[model samples]
Target: MQATNTLPLDMVYHWEATKADSLYLTQPVGNDQVVEYTWGRAVDEARRMASYLKSLNLPEKSRIGLISKNCAHWIMTDWTIWMAGHISVPLYPTLNAETVNYILNHAECDVLFVGKLDDWEMMKPGVPDSVRCISFPLSPPNDFETWDDIIARCSPLEENVQREPEELATIVYTSGSTGKPKGVMLTFLNMAYAAEGGMEVLKVGSDERMLSYLPLAHVFERTFVELASLYAGFHLFFAESLDTFVEDMQRAQPTLFLSVPRLWVKFQQGVLQKLPQKKLDTLLKIPVVNKLIKKKILKGLGLDKVKLAGSGSAPLAGDVLDWYRNLGLELLEGYGMSENFAYSHINKPGRSRTGYVGENMPGVETKISPEGEILIKSPATMLGYYKDEEKTKETFTEDGFLKTGDVGEIDEAGRLRITGRMKEIFKTSKGKYIAPAPIENQLMANQSIEQVCVSGANQTQPFALVQLAEGVRDKVADEAYRKELETTFSQLVDRVNKTVDPHEQLAFIVVMSDEWTIENNFLTPTLKLKRNVVEDTYEGKINDWYAQRKKVIWQ
Candidate 1:
């Protein structure tokens, strides 16, 4: 695999099957017809899109807002916007009405492209009256023109485009942790280098099948799915919906895979539900039953053919990864944040590390500061926050290295292991500090626990608030069943405490039930549990969980 500096120099990476032939995406967009296109045809569509943009008489770098789920049309429209020398602003599909308006307004968007949307009309309140909104629906409404109509009206035109490597490609607004969304400005060169770096690392063959289910609007997916696949000739496919993702994967049989920790846990939970943890533990004690159970679990998930699998966006327990390996799937975890265009580091092919994010991607320099926070310099790093000069300045050092908010250690093998978030660390009255995410992930690895929140604030001992799995509803409600849960939880807590530092051990275990969902504002679009919300919601409920002060709090 070549280094980032030596890989792709252009936005689109393609392959040749015949004369001028290349690979592209195939999918159904919300009951829309299944459609497929060759790379050559897609290029033609993009050029036509650019032609329409050239006729708009807009000034250079005029912002264009594009709100859509992942689709081939999304990429075609994105490339078209860049081809016309305009900036692209992509909105997340799962955003609420407030953020839809916020991103369009913040970007000062002059034109909007709406793609095969869900609940689109209800979301229209966010658009400014002055902004001309166009629809890219598979079947556009009578009032607005479909993308095909717009492309047909404009004559086919290609440009002698001139863009510096440092030119801004798109503005990606991250979900707000404090209040409102902040746009992160990413340059074409910054993104291109990162995609190339990932290609250099994974080295998967161009013929590999990739399922593009994650939101392409995200920097992580855009760099890996949109850009990396283009350069590698991988045939990309999209899911019909979340419920049908597994079906699509079986059809596509994707060789390369990526998912957040929570989704992977859901996959594991589904299997374990069929064969409860107690049954699994019992079977594992007997070698014959253990081998048979592992085989059954792997076959059920269709992971038998999964060439590569990995989880990121949150910490995953080492034990979970080991379990997958025992069943013959080598699940490696990687680490990166939005600022690095989401490709700063990844695990190497054969060399796997438990806590460390793999080595820095090619061309990215990394180091640990005196305080142990990770510092990085890469062409892939975001240029800065959009329209927020002060925040941008605060995010970098005097010499321009992006300050990764994580504390970490670098091992002799060059793998980077994250300890905790700098701001997330909480000090106890006993003068010991704790990072909650790792402890929480470990707790959730227990078969019954779905989500876990750990906080100490001003208290002497830290504790966990965990939600039981939905499938365990029967046991969750039964008092006799509840007793068994308490017993299991107490042992789980004791086992965890012996493994970690005395100060970091969880003192109380609270069994909770309300699911952490996007609809309820408890999870990010990427599915990470909202730490702030968890701490805030459970603050009053803490006493209810701690009232008994037993080893486990089961209500």
Candidate 2:
């Protein structure tokens, strides 16, 4: 395989020949059992599967759909698609049947690979009978062809397969925060550029170990964990389930970790439950005790071996970032989008500044438009949206810069700090426009609040609708605790008000009784709040909430 501008398949071939017996993937089965795959064995399985795919005689570049949680066979199937000269389309495991149907038909999929999933019955109706179905070893009982059965019958593809850098590699659909999701078409070159660049910046190598729990359907994990592993030849581990996540993490002892803000906060809350904040703060002040305490906490969370940890996909609370820093962890924040394959910007190891996303990546240029939208031009920019040429043209400026919908500022040191989304800024009836993201971040600093949405679209003043944290909810049922929380939240609002302009100050906070979750469609699969869904759910009660004129009202 040629090394120049290498694609993922090229690196896969390189590792298979040089490190044939090296362990590449570790997958957890049920009941404390695991299966490991070596480089040679894994490629052999992919080769056999590729031969099976080729027998179908699908048209060149035909779309093949993959629906599964992160598992060993998921990666193998992706490689098989490319080797068979087909494009891959991965759907989020949590997507509803309606969305699954929409995506499969929209992509004109010829075949579907169904792997480990929790809700196969619910999603089964989504797969049109016209499309062929293949099942993985871990898949729920179905009549579809099994991976092991196909491998047993077929011979491995003997010739080394190579893909042109400009060929279509994958189509990733957005999480659909507002409306229908659009397919972002990324080429082999786009993925190669991002994976290679990230590997260089992070200094990853074969010695590095990482846990893959984030959805590979999303660009962030696909580019960093899947594609980067191919480039760097690192050991990758799959998380079994939510119940076994801690055990899985411990088994890997990952040298590199990546997480979203919500999971990071949950880890903090879990630690604080074991040791109260006041007592923990006092212990940390002692020079000798602080080191031991930090070590114990990291070890307990199965992160003692983590050399670098990152948070992305949403704005993390500043207070949460500071908490991790105090524990001697170098937690960095980054900024990117699906249009650029998430290769835009990341903080330098020793040069990171708090609250800023960091400087532009290598070979990337960024500029703030006159309207304050962040525009970026990078080596990994997508070819275009899958089939929407008009929308694709509108997304880019005449100079070829992708228009990121985020409004942000660049400092003198070139660090970028995001303010809010352009479409999320809502105007009140009093003719004042308020950006909700910064205010929501401020609200998240309070440990009692789990999720907050600040909306006052046509009202006189902005207000917050918040779901109380899980640990705090049980206590709120008690009369005494409820009154105490009311007082604490009142003071919290006053503090937040003093920091913002008069119009931006919130009128009150509404404690919601209902939970916001992916199952309820209040949050995207990536855990981002769907503002439109949240606002519409409470539109009829906004006037009632304000009529009480209380500092805090419980819904």
Candidate 3:
């Protein structure tokens, strides 16, 4: 293991110079080859940006925000924000205008950094005039000051801008399922402790390689990208674009892979793309082809070289875990919230519980309250919600453990298995409580269904709002074919309903024409369905789906 040198920002260059010199990000620069940056250059850029930030003279702990997608600028901007004395706030780039304005006002931020995004111009109307905006990569509307312009106007590096371990560093706003967004305040010590703990757990070292594809605005990516990669020297490769993600994954062939459950399912779907179910099943009947198929899939996902592959943000299915295990991938599920720096319980390498979210992470203590809420306390937990003392005070018990909102059980082996969100579970007319998650997880295992939201409020039986697999629309565009598919879907609902108890049966199944996405606000950034949106859209229609009671028919 290489020793880490303390700097204002995390550095791959100083600790692992050779690997850092390797091409890290591989994205396009217009029509030319991909614009690549070396770790040495990245560290220097962060320092220069930090120096520029010091020139601004913002008050200590003042809120600063960046609106952008997952890009090289995102990291540089984050480094600069932290390197400065001011606190950092990152917003969802895809947020609606109303939500964006609310967050901007809620944070009371006066200075905002803007970056390249899809339809950025459309959102300009909602930005508060009080906030001064600087464009990143400082592209056009030539009136605004560019990032480089700021750097050029700053004093030279002093070599004395230090970040104390306990200072408030970053504030991340979470789009919670039950309510509007709230800023979660975290200190340098909180992040560093999580990074430090993760390093030991993963046995990460200089030789380890990682691919950064998830949104860095989220806590999981911030810890993994900033802290872990710094302390343990790992080379990073960024995806070129949305169109080039799979090819880029092939090119990077990373050893340490981390993804949310949605991407994990997508990767599995990609594997199945080439090998259709009927054909793959027929080939598995033959001995040699089955072994070869497994090898092919394991290699395709870059998992052939993977030391660890994790599913987090949401629970993955046991059957899905079994399927991945067949291909020689170590699929471990982890559980944590944005409130705790996303590292409370992890399915560590070698010792894994496919059903459980794994044992508590090192130095973190987890206990289930009598009401089945998961309670955790550690240095890694956030200091509190930013400026919301009432909510923060309510987040903890009298003994000072943070309430996780998740309903879970700890087994004899001390592994945590989350059953459902306490609020999401609903009671049926028969008085039997239905846990939506397990049913939804099982429904998702079917490749045809993309997103499923289960609900049973004031209904005899629970139901699902299903988003279809990608390209399912174009494939079924024909009116006749669409009708046929609707018929087949009803059959599918009947099959699924037969497998469960009477009260738990899916009485309603609606196929969404448009996909549920983070941008659409139907899904949170983490890709979990916003149950409220799904329920709101179908609340009146759910009864309609059941009133017809006609199988083998279109709506």
Best by lDDT: 2
Cα RMSD for candidates in order: 2.8, 1.5, 3.2
lDDT for each candidate structure:
0.77, 0.91, 0.75
Of the candidates numbered 2 and 3, which has the greater TM-score value? 2
Segments in model 1 whose C-alpha atoms lie over 4 Å from true places = 1-20, 29-33, 138-142, 160-162, 277-299
Alpha-carbon shift of residue 15 in model 2 (angstroms) = 0.4
Would you estimate the TM-scores of all the predictions?
Answer: 0.92, 0.99, 0.91
Per-residue alpha-carbon lDDT of model 3 for 1-555, expressed as tens digits? 122234335443354345546554444444335566666556556667777667667777678888876666677677677766677888876777777788888888867888756657666767899887888772336356787777666654546356776788888899676588988988877777788777877778867777777777788877766566667766666665677766767767888888988888787777677777677778877887888887787887667788788778888877678778777788888877789888798877677877789988777888889988889988888889988999999999898899998899988888899989888889987888888998888778777666777887878877777777774656677888777777777777777787788788887676677678887778887787789887886677666777876543232
> Which segments of model 2 are wrong by more than 4 Å?
1-4
TM-score order of candidates, best first?
2, 1, 3
Query: How many residue pairs collide in each prediction?
Result: 1, 0, 0
RMSD of candidate 2 to the truth, in angstroms, is 1.5
lDDT of 1 by residue, 1-555 (tens): 222343232544223223236557787655545677777777777778889888888989999988878888888888788878888999887788788888988899999888766667666778788787677755235366568888778766644465566788889988645468789998877777887777778876677887887777877788777887777767888877777776777766777777777777778888877877677778878977877777677667756567888777778877777767767678888887778888777877689887667887788788888988899988888889999999999999988889989998889989988888887899987999998878886787787777778897777789988888767755666788888888888898998899889888887887766778876889877777778888887788766655667888754
